[model samples]
Target chain A: MKIIKFTFALLLCATISSCSSDDDTENLTGKLGNIIIKFDNGVDDQDFIFGTSYNTSSGESYKLETLKYLISNIRIKDNNGDTFMYPSEKNVFIIDEADGNNAGEIWVTLNDIAAANYTEITFGIGIDQDRYALGADGQGDFLAKAEEEGMMWSWATGFRFTRLDGTYSSDTVTDEALNIHMGSVGTAVDNYREVTLSLPNMAIVREDKTPELHVKADIAKLFDGTTSVSFDEGYSQVHVDETTTGVIANNAMDMFMVHHVHND
Target chain B: MKKIFLLASALMFWLGCAKSEIQENYVPIPLEVEQPSNFPDIVYNLDNNLVTEAGFELGKRLFYDGKLSANGAIPCAFCHEQAFAFTHHGHTVSHGVNGGIGTRNAQPLQNLAYQSEFMWDGAASHLDFQPIIPLTSELEMGETLTNVIDKLSLDIYYQEQFKKAFEDGEINSENMLKALSQFMLMLVSSNSKYDKYVREEDNVMLTQIELDGFETFQNKCASCHATDLFTDQSYRNNGLSINPKLNDEGRYSIFENPNDKYKFKVPSLRNVEKSFPYMHDGRFATLEAVLNFYDSGLVNNGNVDPTLLRNDNTYGITLNEYEKESIIAFLKTLTDNEFLTDERFSEY
Candidate 1:
C-alpha cells in the first residue's frame, strides 16, 4: 500500500511537471536536484577572517593568513534511511577560507543529487583511505587545484587535509609561527576522521528546489575540543605526528554542525 | 571428420570476426603484468589503471621525455640510467636541472609494483603518486603537473598516444600518472641469479662463496631485509654519521616524531651490486664500505637501530673479512641483466 501510494504520488507530480508543490506531498522519486553545502568558518561565534586574532582556551592567540580543509565522501541519508552519495569523480572539495565570499561563506554546490527528504548528512574531514588507494582514478584535475592552493606537499604524495598557517602567541612565545597541516600519513598513521550531523530540519530536495545546508565549522574546536592543545606545547605545529595529529583530527570531527537548511 | 572440420572452420571464422571487430573499434591491447611468485603480493592497485599496450608505451615515452621538466632538458631517465639498475651511475646523489643537487640517492625503478610506500623516507604513499614528487621537486624536474600536462597536450604524438591509452582520452594529470603507473607496473625484475636459485629455476645454484654469503646475510642482515624481496619495507636509522650539510632528517621531516629521527627506509637490496653508491645518501661507493660500515663504521647517531646494537652494548654488526667478501659476492648475484636490457622498458 505504501509503495503504491508513493508511486501514485510520483506519477501525479510527473503529470504536473512540478516536484515542489506547496501541498504536503513531495515528489521524492524520479527527479534530480542540486544542493549547495555552504561552509562558514567561525571561532565559536565570530566569523573566522584572515589576519584576525582568535583567542584559544589556553590564553593563546592565533591569526591565520591561510586556512583550507578538504571535505570528501559526502552522503545524504534520507528520512527512509536510504543514503545517496555524490559521485566520487565530483564529490571531493577543498574548502579554502580565502575563497569565501564577502559574507564569509564558501559554497560547494553539488549538482544532480537524487531527490530525497534528507535528515542526516555525513562527510569525511580528509582524503579517505579508499580515495587514496584509487591512486589517480576518479581524481580528474583536482591534483593541480590542490597543488595551486598549496594544499599538496611536494616532498610527499599526500594532501594536506587542513592547512592553517599564521602566528600563534602564547604566555611566553610572542607570535611564534603556527602551522597545522594535518593529514593521514599513508597506510601508516591514519588521521582521517568522519562526522555525521543530523540536520536541524528536514532538507526537502526536488527537481525545482535548490536546498542549501548552512554548515558552521568552529575553528576554535580544532585546538580546544575533546583535547585542549596549547600553542606553546608540541601541537603549535600539528603535522604528521600520529598522536598529536590524531587528537586534532578528533577535535576537527567535532567542529562541524549544520545550523540550518533553506529549501528554495 | 567432415563435420568436425566444418565446426572448426565456423568457430575460427567467429573468432576472426570478433578479433577484427576489436581492432576496428580501436580497443586497447591489454598487456599482462607478471607477478613473480617469489615477491610479495602487489601493493599497487592495478584495477585503477590496467596495463595496456598503448598505456605502457605512453608511460615509457613520458618517462623519457624531457618536456616534463621546466627547462625541457632533464628527463626521468636522466637520473635513472638502465645500466646501473636505474640509479644515477656513480653519483652520490643525483644532479638535476641547472646542476641542482639532490639530498638523497636516486632509487632503482624495478619491482615497484610489489612495494606499498615509495621514497627513502616513504614520502610517496603509492606508486602512481611517486612521480609527482620528482616531477615537481625544484632540485629535480621542477615542473608543475599542469604545466607538464599542457606541454604534453601540444605534442601530436602524445595526443594520439593519449587517445589510444585512455578511454576518456584527455591529456590530464590523472591519465598521465596512470600511464606512468602502468609502465612501472611492468618493471618486475624477479629473474636474478639469486631469485632463480631460490625458485629452483634452470637448475641455477649459488657458488660456494655466494652460499656462504647467503648464510652470513641470513644470520646478520635478514632481520631488516626479511622477505625474498630483500626488504621488510621498514624505516630504520642505519647508523651513518649525520651528514649535516643536507641535514636531511629522513622520515623525521615527514612526521616530526622524535623516535623517527634519522630514520631512512630499509631499502631493498635486490640489485645491490648494480645499484651502487649505496645508502640513502649514497655515502659508500662499494659494498665493501657498506658492509664494513655495518661491521665497525656505524655511529651512534642517537637513534641507531637496536638490531645494529651488539649484545655487548656496542653498535655495528660483527662481520669478518671472509664474511664481508662472501656477502659482496652474493650481492652480485642479485644483478638482473635481463631486466636492465629489457626492450619494452628501454627508451630506445
Candidate 2:
C-alpha cells in the first residue's frame, strides 16, 4: 500500500512539473508583440507646424510648407545586449509632417517584435547603399511611397533624406525659396546616417502588450548642431553639395532623443 | 490508444503537405538575361527582380499601353517608336499628353541594362526608376504614379498579368515597375555589323572605307565615344553654344556645381544614323551638320571639356571632308537591323 502511495505521489509531482514547464516555455519562446514609435518634430522649444514661422540661432526666421524625411534600418538592443533587427524587407519608413495628428505626433507602428525589455533603438536617416543597390525590386512599396510624399528627387534616383521646403527671411532676403532637399548623389556620395537613442528606461514588451516610445526631433539642431551653417552663406538651397549636405546629415544625427516610454 | 495516435499523426502529416502545396503556386521561373561577348558587364542588378517570361510580356504590354498616361492616349511607344531604334523619329523634342512639348530630345532605348545612369543629365541612376521621369513629367505622360496604379488595378488584364508575373503579385507600383524593368533589360542592341565584325561572327568583314573610318574614329573620337558600347559614359561640356531661351543648365542643374555647368552625358552612337536630329537639344539636323559642328562650330563655353582643347587653344576636331564621310560610314555600321526589326519589341 505504501509502495502504491509513493508511486502516486511521484506521478502527481511529475505531472505538476510538466505543466509548469510547458507554461514557462510558452511565456519565454516565440512571443511576438508590437511597438509604436512616436516622432514629435519641434523647432527648438516650439512644436513644428505648417506655415508657422520659427527663428533659428543663425539670425534667420523660417516657415515650412513641406517637411518630410526617410527613416530606415530600424533595430533595438535588449537589456542582455541581444539586438533585434526589424525585417529588412519592411523596415523603411517616411515621416511626413503633414501626416501628423491634431497633437502634432507622427506614429510608426512596428509589428511582430520579439517580446523583451528593449534598451536602445537605432535607425537610419536615409536609404543606405545596400538598399539602393537592390534597385526597384528591393524597394517594394517604398519607392512609390517616397515619390508620392515628394521626399524623392524627381530628377535623380535617390531619396531626399530630409526635405525642408519653405521660405526663409534674413537681413537681406524675405521668403526666398528655402529648399533643403539633401540626399546622396547616386553611388558617388553617401549622405545616409545612422542614429541610436538610448531609452530613458527599459521598455517592457509582452505578447499581449503594445509599448509606445516618444522620440523628439529638434529641427533647429539641423542647422546649428556640430557645424553652424548660416542661411546667408548659400546654405538656403541644400541639395547634393557634399560639404553642405554632410553638415546637415551630421547635424540631423543629433536631432533625435528618446523622451519617454509607455509600457502599456 | 495506439490506433488513435496513428490516426492523429496521419492527419497532421496530411495538413502539413496541403499547406506546402498551396505555397508551391508562387514558385518563380527564373529567366536569364543574355550578355553579349563584346559588351561590358551589365550594370543592372538582375538578382533582385529575376527576369521571367510572364514578367517580360507584361512589361512589353505596359510599354505599348496608353493607360499609363493621364489623357489615356499617349504611351511610351508614342515617343519611342521601334522602327527608329526607339527614338522620336522626326521631332526635335517630342510632344506628350495634352500636346505638352518637352524640352530635351528623346533618347533611344537600347543597351539600357549596361548603363548605370539615364537621361542626358544623368538624372536617373537606375534603369527601373528611369520611367518615373517621363511618366510623371507634365511634358510627357502627365500622370501620377498612384493614378496609374489605380487605373492598372481596375483592368482585368493587368490583374491576371500581375498574378502571373510576381509571386506576391498585387497590382501595385512595385510589381509594375519590376515588370517594366524586366522588359527594358532585355532590349540589348549588340548584333550590329561592327559588333559582328569584331566578334568574328558570320564571316563578317568591314570594307576598306569603313575600316579606314574605324581607324580615324579610333584616333579622333575614341576618347569620349569609347568601347564597343560607343560611349565612355562621362558627362562633359562639349562646347555647344548655349540656347539662352531654354536656359537648360545641363548637369549643373542637378547639383548646382559651377564645374558641372553645360556638361551633358556623352551619348552612345549605337543607332546614330536613325536617331536624329542629334545632340542634347537636337540642334544639328543631319550627321553632316553634327560633323561640321565638331569641325568648326564649337564655341568657347567656359566649362568646355579640356580634352577638346587643341594645341592651338581651339575646341574643334580637325576633320576634313573625306574623314567626315568615312566616320559617317563607320557610324552607319553601328546600325543593328536585328534590334530595330526584332518582333519581340515591336508594337504591331
Candidate 3:
C-alpha cells in the first residue's frame, strides 16, 4: 500500500510539473499559428444586409446597394504587451459587403501569427500614407484586386478607401445619393484612422489551434457617430473633400468593436 | 577504383550541364539601355527593376501577345505599333477589343523613362501602373488583371518566359508589369537628326529652313514644349474647342477642380511627324491644321492659358506662314527613323 502511495505521489507531481512547464514554455516553443478575424458588420443591433433600411440619429433612413472599405495595418497586442504586426506586403485587405458570406462575416485570415495569449487588436480603417506612397513598388495582386472591385477611381491613382453607395431619405428630400467615397488624394488629404479594441477573452494561439475574433462594425455610427451628420445638408454626397470627409472618417473610426473571441 | 570515381563525377557534371541547357534554359544576360546625353536624368528607378535580355524579350512577347485581351485579341502592340513610334497608325480614336472605340487618341510611346506622368490627363503617375488603365478599360483591351494572369498562367511558353524573366519565377501581375517596364525602358529614341546635331555626332548639320523653323519653335513653342524631351511636363488648357459629344473634362474629372477643366498634359514633340491625328481627341489630321490653330484659331474656352494671352485680349501665339512652315519642318527633324525600324521593338 505504501509503495502504491509513493508511486501515486510521483505520478501526481509529474503531471503537475509537466503542466507548469507547458505554461512556462508557452511562447518560447517557437511555433507559429493562424488567427482569423471575422468582421461582422451591423447597423446598431441588426445584421447588415443589402437594401436594408437603417435609420440614423439625424432622422434619416438609408439603404445601401454597395459597400466596401479598405482595412489595413492589422496588428494584435498580447497580454504581456508584445505587439504582433502582420506582414506589410500581405496586410491590407478590402472588406466588401458583396464579398461577405450569408452570415455577413468578412473573414480576414492572418497567417504565421506567433503563439501567444493576445488581449487586444489594433487595425487601421483605410490604406495609410506609406502604402499609398509606394505606388507600384510593393503592390502585387492587391492593386489588380482593388481595380477589379471598383475601389479605385479610373482617372487617378488614388484609391476610394471607403465606398458607401446608397440612397438616403431625409426630411427635405426622398432617396438621393449618399455616396461617401472618401480617401486620401495623392499625399494631400490623408483620412486613415486606427482603432484599438480590447478582446473580452484571452486568445491563446497555439500551433495546433486556430483562434477567431468576431469584430462588430456598427456602420450606423458613420452618420451618427462622434459628430452627428445630417443627410439633408451637403454631407450626403461625400467624396475627397478635406472638411466633409474628415468628419466622416472621424465618425468611421468609432465603428468597430471586438464582440467576442473563440480559441478553437 | 580512382578511375571509377573519376568517371562517376564526370557523368554527374555532364548531366547537370545538360539538364540546365534543356529543361531550365535561363541565364541573366543584362541588356544595356542607353541614356542619351541631351535627355534628362532617368526618372525610373533601375535598381528596383534591372533589365535583362530574357526579361526584355519576355516583355516584348507579352506586349505583342493577343492573349492579354478579353476576346483573345487586342494586345498592347495592337494599338502601339513600332513603325509609328508605338502609336496606332492612321487611327484618330483607336478601336479596341470587340469594336469598342476609345475616347482619347493613342499617344506615341517614346522617352517614357524621362517622363514623370503618363496619359493625356496625367492619369497614371507611374509608368508601371499605366497598363492597368487600358487593360481593364471597357472601351480598350477589356480584360481584368486576374483574367489575364489566369490566361498567362495556362500557357507553357509564358511559364518558361516567367521563369527566365523574374527571380521568383512566379507568373504574377508584378513580374508581368516589371517585364513590360523592362521592354519600355529599353525603347530609347535618342538617335534622331536633332539628337545627332545636338550631340555633334556623325558630323550632322541642319539646313537653313530647318534652322529657321528651329528659331521660330524656340521663340514661341519652346515655353510649353521645353527641353530635348520637347515637353515642360505640365498640364495646360491649349484653347481647343470642346467636343460636346465626348465632353471630356480632362484633369477636372480627377478632383472635380473647376480650374483644371479642359487641361491636358503637353505631349513631347519627339516623333510628332508620324504621331498624327493630333490633339488629345485627335481632332486635327495634319501639322498644318495644328499650326494654323495655334496661329489664328484661338478661341475663348473659359480658362485659356494666360501665357497664350495676346495683346488683343485673344489667346494665341501669333505666327506668319513662313514661321508656321519652318516650325513644321523643325518638328519633322525630331523623328527618329532608327527607333521606328528598330527590330528589338518589332513584332516580326
Candidate 4:
C-alpha cells in the first residue's frame, strides 16, 4: 500500500511541477515598442497631391481613393552599431489615407523590441525581392494585407509598386491628370522599393524597454520634378508612353534617397 | 473497492455511449475528388462539410431553393444553369431578385481552384469572399445575410444538414459561406476535349483547318489566353469600347487609376462556347462577335494594348472568312460536356 501511495505521490508531484513550469514559461511575455509614422506633406504644402495617373508625360493622372501600402523586413541599429532585424514572420507597417491625400499619421506595435537605444531603423517600402520571389507563403502580414486591401495586383504581370496621383496642366489643358504607377513583375523591374528611416534622436526610457520608433513620409517628394500631361489631346496611356514609365520608375527609385534612416 | 471500480467502468462505458450517440446524430461526408497530378493540391477542402450523399443533397437543395431568395421566385440555380456551364444563357447581365442588373457579366465557374482572384475586376481575391458580394448585392439576392440565416435556421431540413456538416449543428455566416464554397468548389471542369488533347489521354484529332486556327490563336490571342489553364492572370485593355450605359472602367473602378482604364482580367477560354456574350459588359452575344470585335472592331485610344491597335485606327488580327471558321472550330474543342453533366455535381 505504501509503495503504491509513493508512486502516486511521485506522479502527482511530476504533474504539478510540469504545470508550474508551463505557467512560468507562459508568464514570460516579450517587450515591444510603438511605431508612429508621420507623413510630412510639407514641402510647399498647399493641398499636396501624391497620386498615379495617365494624364501626365509620366503616364496618366491617377487619384488615390485609398493609398495604404505595406512596409516590412525591418532592421534596427543601436548607438553601438549593433543591428537587429525583426523576425521575418510578422514585420509589416502601413500608412494609408483614402480621398487622394495623406492623413499624416499611422501607428503599429513592434514586437520583441529589446531594451536598447536604437539610433537608426531601416525597412523596405514594400516586400523585398527575396520575399516577393519566395512566392505566396513567404508573404506575411504586409503582403497579405496589401493583397486584402486591393493594393497588390493579380500575382505577377506587374504590381503597382508605387501609386501617385493628382491634377496637373499640360500645354493644352489645365487640371489634367498627373499619375505615376510604378510596378515590375518578372525581370529586374520588380517594383518593391526599399526605404530606410532615420529617427530624430529622442530617448524612450523604460525599465527593460525600447524607445518608440517614429518614421516620417514626405508626400511632396513623390512628384518633386514631375508634372501632369493630358490624355485627351496627347493620345497616350500607361504602357504606350515612355515619359510616364520613366517618371514612375525614377520616382520610385528616388524614394530610397529621400527617406532618412534613424531611431531614437 | 469492487463497487467503486464497477462504477468507474460504468462511467467509462456511459461516456462511450454518449460519444456514440453524437456520432449517430452527425453524418460524416466523403472528401473524394480529383486532385490534379500536375497542378498543386487544393488549398481548401470541405472536411467540415463532409462529402456524404446526404450533405451534398442538402447543399444542392439549399442551392436550388427559392426560399433563400428575397423574391422567393429566384433561386441560386436561376442565374447559374447547370446546362449552360453554370452561367446564365443569353442574359447580357444577370437579373437580380427585383429585376436589378449586376455591373459585370456573370462569370461561368469551372476549375475555380486554379483561379487566384474572383470577379472581372479582381475585387474579391478569395473564393470564400466572392459569395459575400453576390449575397449582399442589392441587385442580386436582394436579401440580407441575416435574413437568409434566420430563414435557414427555421428549417428542420437545413438544421439537420447543418448538424451533419458542422460542429454541434451550429449555423452562422462562416459555416453558410463555407458550405456554399464546398458546393461551388466541387464544380470542377477538367474533362474537355482540349484537356484530353493536352493530356494525350484521347485519340482525338484536329483537322488541318482547326490546326491553322490554332496557329492563328497562338499568334494573336495566346498571350492573354495561355495554354491548358487558358489565362495569363493579367488585366489588359482588350480594346473594348466602353458601353456608355454601363460606364464600366473595369480595373480602373477598383484602382481609381486612369492608366488602368478599360482594363479587364482575361477570362479563361476553358468552356468559352457556353459562356457567351463575352467581355465585362456582355456586349457581344456570340464568340463570332467577340472575334469580330478583336478582328476589326477594337476602338482606338490610350491604354489599349499595342498588339490589338492597328496604325489605321482599326484593331489588329483581320481574319478571313475561312480563318474565322477554323478559329471557331478550334475554340469548340474546349467544350467539356462531362463537367456540365457530372453526376457528383448534379442536383438530382
TM-score of each: 0.54, 0.53, 0.54, 0.51
Overall local distance difference test of candidate 1: 0.85
Over the stretch A206-236, how does candidate 1's per-residue lDDT look in tens digits?
Answer: 8888899989899999999999998888988
For model 1, what is the error of residue A76's alpha carbon versus the real structure, in angstroms, after optimal superposition? Answer: 77
DockQ score for model 3, please? 0.01
Question: How high is the lDDT of residue A119 in model 1?
Answer: 96
Please give, for residues B1-348, the per-residue lDDT of candidate 3 as tens digits.
467679999999999898667755557889877888899988988888889999999999999998889987899998898888898875557778875778788998888888889999999998889988999998889999899999999998898888987778889999999899899989989999999999999999999999999999999999999999999999999888665446788989877899999999999999999987788877666888788778766668898889999998988999999999998898899999999999989989
lDDT of 3 at A72: 92
Cα RMSD for predicted model 2: 24.3
Model 4, TM vs. native: 0.51
State the lDDT of candidate 3 residue by residue for A131-243, as single tens digits. 88888678789989988988887535488888899999878888888898888776788888999999999888888888999888988898989999988887888887899
lDDT of 2: 0.86
**TM-score, structure 2 vs. true:** 0.53
Lowest lDDT 10-residue stretch of candidate 2 chain A: A44-53
| lDDT for position B73 in model 2 | 88
Which tens-of-lDDT digit does each residue in A1-264 have in candidate 2? 666887899999999988887844555458889999989787654456566556677888777888888899999999989999999989999998878653356899999999988999999999998888887776688888888888777535587899999899899999888989998878778999999999998887788888889888988888889888888887899998988998999999989999888786
Off by over 4 Å in 1: A1-264, B1-26
Give the per-residue lDDT digits (tens) of candidate 1, residues B99-120.
4678888999888888899899
Candidate 4 A-chain TM-score = 0.62
Give candidate 3 misplaced runs (Cα > 4 Å).
A1-264, B1-26
Residue-level lDDT tens digits of model 4 in A1-264: 766887899999999988888833533224445443333222221222233221223433334333444566777776667776887877755555442111223445565565455666677665567776776675555556666555566666434555544455445565655444445554455455565555567334234443444343434345543443344544223432445555544454343322332233
Query: How high a TM-score does candidate 1 get?
Result: 0.54
* Model 4 ranges with Cα > 4 A deviation: A1-264, B1-24, B37-55, B310-314
List where candidate 2 sits over 4 angstroms from the true fold: A1-264, B1-27
